[model samples]
Target: MASPGAAAAPRRGHSPLLLAAALLLALAPSPTTAAGRGVARECTYTLRVKTSCASPAARTSDAVAVAFGDAYRNEAHAARLPTTSGSRALERCGTDTFRLSGP
Candidate 1:
């Protein structure tokens, strides 16, 4: 039986495992292509993306980014800038601003 004042904690070895995981993650490369040019970069710069329009077909399909970075594979949508015209054509798709300092 345990003592009344005694408390339990995780094993000390757990830290090493976590450190290893963090190291691996820091060294891992973001998913990209053979070109590696778009293999993602340290998200220190502000990517002000703008497009003329996005057809209805573009709604569900992958976005065609002309910027210099890896495609937003699974990043969350921050906001959508719809056109005042209220047509299929949109002024901007969406905006994602963040600091992604990683490979």
Candidate 2:
């Protein structure tokens, strides 16, 4: 009992929920593979730390220490980042590069 000129709603094979689920699955990160089992791999990280020079005491005499790792307990530690060479600081703002390897 509808008008003849009225348009019919379109049907799609992919529903909104199905499309959303597919998109999420596509964007998900892939799990790590075991291809290199027992083999050691190294990871290098370059960290750059900057301090605000606006303050009169922008520089610090204390040493800077860094520690980082993954959730699985794999970690790297540095007792102190080399900020100075002899009496003079290498640079107020500089980059520290380091590498860590593990099996």
Candidate 3:
């Protein structure tokens, strides 16, 4: 029995639920642990990645990342990976690290 214009309008009932979810997510604690702040012990790991192109001297300005996962799908990602040379020297990329929890 609704009019054409009323049927065409979007529903408003979900807005409050969405807003509450956003607020909860904003107030939730981040999953990352600082170097010495948490009770759980943490470790630092180093990974070396190599890429091959048609030209041996060619390099890319693209950002490189590293990720590893376990059988249960738990994953760790390193978004600030720096380029390295054959002699294990790091390129002049800035050092930054990011951490989050998800699949």
TM-scores of the candidates are: 0.21, 0.45, 0.33
If both were scored by lDDT, which would come out higher, candidate 1 or candidate 2? 2
Instruction: Name the runs in model 2 displaced over 4 angstroms.
Output: 1-35, 86-103
- Lowest summed lDDT over 10 consecutive residues: which window, candidate 3? 17-26
Rank candidates, TM-score, best first: 2, 3, 1
lDDT of 3 by residue, 1-103 (tens): 7876674544554311111001111122335645345444233443433232222233444445556655745455667555445523222322223333333
The RMSD of every model to the true structure, in order and in angstroms, is 18.4, 19.9, 17.6
CA lDDT of each prediction against the hidden true structure: 0.32, 0.42, 0.38
Best by TM-score: 2
lDDT of model 3, residue 96: 27
lDDT of 1 by residue, 48-82 (tens): 43332332223322222222323554232224322
Rank order (by lDDT, best first):
2, 3, 1
Which candidate has the highest lDDT of all? Answer: 2
For model 1 the TM-score comes to 0.21
Q: List the residue pairs that clash in candidate 3.
A: none
lDDT of 2 at 77: 61
